[model samples]
Target: MSWKKTSITIVMGNDKYPKGTRTATFNNIVPDPTEKQIKSFAEGLQLLSDGDTYLGSEVIKHDQLSAE
Candidate 1:
């Protein structure tokens, strides 16, 4: 039984829409990523954004099941 990371989703909060309206998704993330790496990546994205705020990030993963 193993899980594989599929992508990272960055949620952005907008002034007009308080409940976060934008999201940036990056696929094919490295396996078992560190917290620091995810934080740094989100912060870096915040810098490039216009007025959107960095609400948080979501690390999406999926597991494969097989019957023997």
Candidate 2:
């Protein structure tokens, strides 16, 4: 399967809503995804752990994302 590249902004200041709401931007994709695909992809990624996901964050800005 061909996978597209995406960058998501995860605000994990705390595990509560309004504070932990995340934003994802899927760019350079061959074709735009459907609503189901979008939801599925985000949910799948959200299931990752700190050990499984190499996330980077700026302590000052509180912006979190997968480093690589």
Candidate 3:
């Protein structure tokens, strides 16, 4: 089996919505990426997406299996 369709969700929160959160989802990521890599990517994405209240991130991956 292998990992496929990997994605990362960047979560953010702001003073206006202290208990609320927002997220940005990026798909088609390289499988098994490092934390540092995700962080850097998220930071850059945040800048471009105008997300100033970065909280954290989550990585999601789908398992791919061969029938043969």
Model 2: CA > 4 A from native = 1-19, 49-68
How high is the lDDT of residue 35 in model 2? 50
Minimum summed lDDT over a 10-residue window in model 1 is located at: 14-23
Model 2, 1-68: lDDT tens digits are 33335333433222444644443344443344455654555456657633223232211112236556
Cα lDDT computed for each candidate against the true fold: 0.79, 0.41, 0.80
The clash numbers for all candidates, in the given order, read 0, 0, 0
List RMSD in Å for every model shown: 2.4, 12.7, 2.4
lDDT of 2: 0.41
Per-candidate TM-score against the hidden true structure:
0.70, 0.36, 0.73
- How does candidate 2 fare on TM-score? 0.36
Clashes of 1: 0
Show the colliding residue pairs in model 3. none
Residues 1-68, model 1: lDDT tens digits:
66755788888887666555887799988866688999888778778877767788888877677785
Name the candidate, 1 or 2, with the larger lDDT value: 1
